[model samples]
Target: MSGQNCWGYGGDNGPLNWHKQFPFAQGDRQSPIDIVSAQAVHDADLTPISISYSACTSLSICNSGHSVMVEFEDCGDKTVVSGGPLENPYKLKQFHFHWGQRGRQGSEHTVDGKSYPGELHLVHWNSTKYNTFGEAAVSHDGLAVVAVFLETGDKHANLHRLTDALYMVKFKETKAQFKDFDPQCLLPKCRDYWTYPGSLTTPPLHESVTWIVFKEPILVSEKQMDKFRMLLFSGEEDSEKQPMVDNFRPPQPLKGRTVLASFKL
Candidate 1:
């Protein structure tokens, strides 16, 4: 019930069955909620977000039987994201992608019921208040996830670097050294976003994430996205190989939560 292999996006152990193992899966404040653009209230008091990932150290990339993630060195305040609903600056920990088999159904969080080809999650922890990422993850306001939607269009110049390294960690639980890649390059030009209180989209489903979902999506060609699909959800020793496509969790209920927009509707 606690191991990584116990849960997945398949019909047998998918989001629908996650609640059986992890009770928090059914909790309020869950993540990847459908963003009804008209319902988001513009908050003038909300300041623009500040990001400083230029000095961040990229450590490694791995496949965790779910998604391919790039870990970062967060020993100090070198890489941090602040402002825009966050009370204190959070340290960058890692970044990952959630995608689907096709070009139009990958994104976890949708805009006005519209889904994108994929989504990028730049995860940060409340280092200012908590000593470790683990200590912060279960607490309220302990994590900040910047979510950017990915659309199928022209080839993204920066994404190829990460996609090219996918072959090394094509199987689950495998990792390889990946250094010096700046996540700032993956973000879209527009800074406008919607902020909300939510939980982790994956297992454990901690209600600790302050979600900042961007309005604009970054463009990557369909071919580039296919590289992500090439990844497998099974281990090298496993009998059956499952393609790592449609790894994203569907949008959860909003309940009574308020979603605030940084700009005027």
Candidate 2:
């Protein structure tokens, strides 16, 4: 995983071992960023976003080790990663997190001079064209996500949608009041991000994502960070460090891939 340990049924989720589980896992090579690159990007024009949250029936809210996730039903109306505009968009599906309870030890990407306690990922798919994530996995244009970094703060009054469901997701197939959620407000004021070709940070490790890492991080309070610690491996031996790391995958190799800063090339 992107953290210090692997997160699976056992300790096998480690980055070194992921390739065994999934042949495509990007455990081989990546710059292993200490994640200390949060400096303001040179030039970026953030996209206009509007996310309206409604009750999702198939949300699987659970804590594997990382942060909690509240998934939504998969509707084939997505065009988000279709390499197109929002008009013909993929339906927004699930949203999860990569987090640490305290300190900067567990961040995924090290920003310029700091690393927040965690990051949030809102997963979306392009169903308008691609029938399934499996099918989309092979195409260059498949998924689109908005990532928000969470730093320790006072207490996230607005993020109760995630915290309230922490203890409930013990087994799986769990659902909750992920009510009135919008995927837009989570973005940083600056839209200038590092756009690159990459794969899913989690399982399947599909190499079909249009990665858009925001140049800025969102605020997450200390108490808010602790909410993630509630995650368990469902057993004691899941990993020595419980809730500290969960589904984060190590950064894949730039693979000769060019990182496009929002600034002029």
Candidate 3:
């Protein structure tokens, strides 16, 4: 399992053994690092993240073997995130999640060694310079990902729109049309965040991401999290079935990288 091109978050194929196939897993700038607030350097010059997702068009939702992802219409820049360490506006491509088997520990990126129940990654591409997401994904400065932590608490009404559709895509390689959904409701109240350079937290683990991790976590009920756990890694046709839990990658070494903060810790 360790040498396989396709990887899962369990047993011999887990994060600890990813380096066998993905050399970047052992590379210098891996993602999901433990963000030490005390060590992060606050930069007053860092601009606020400006997101114009009011008209963001949602295309479909699919279970991409690894995680359930919601892809958007990025043919145009209707939905984009700019400012805050970004040289150009990045077009919103897709949004997905990572979680653990249980509600207590699931998020990929930790803060001061603390973990969250889940993490949301909103993937974007540098459309200004790249023709497509596939091309940008492998480029050094081609991608920007917005990461939001999910905590267990009150039910998030907005999350119901997606969770309700989870049953439609309970198995891998499944897809359903999802429309008119705006992601603003899923964001935390505060816009403050920490920024750094890192790689994708999955196989092919390209070191091409500009990560913006929010400081405050959004709330979701335990019941909602259970819905995510119900998703299966195996497709409906496969005789063997596996639940899609603990899909999150562990925090990698930060090396000598500096985490820049937009707000005071």
The C-alpha lDDT values of all candidates are: 0.91, 0.55, 0.89
Best by TM-score: 1
10 residues in a row with least lDDT, candidate 3: 1-10
List runs of model 1 lying over 4 Å from the truth.
1-5
Candidate 1: deviation at residue 176, Å?
A: 0.7
lDDT of 2 by residue, 180-255 (tens): 4555556566654565556666555666666556666777677666767666544444344344443344444545
Candidate with the greatest lDDT versus the true structure:
1
Cα lDDT for residue 175, candidate 2: 38
Report residue 18 deviation for candidate 2 (angstroms).
Answer: 1.7
RMSD of each: 1.7, 5.0, 2.4
Give lDDT for model 3: 0.89
Kindly indicate the candidate among 1 and 2 with the higher lDDT: 1
Q: List model 1 lDDT by residue over 192-227, tens digit each.
A: 999999999988988999999999999999989999
Q: Rank candidates, TM-score, best first.
A: 1, 3, 2
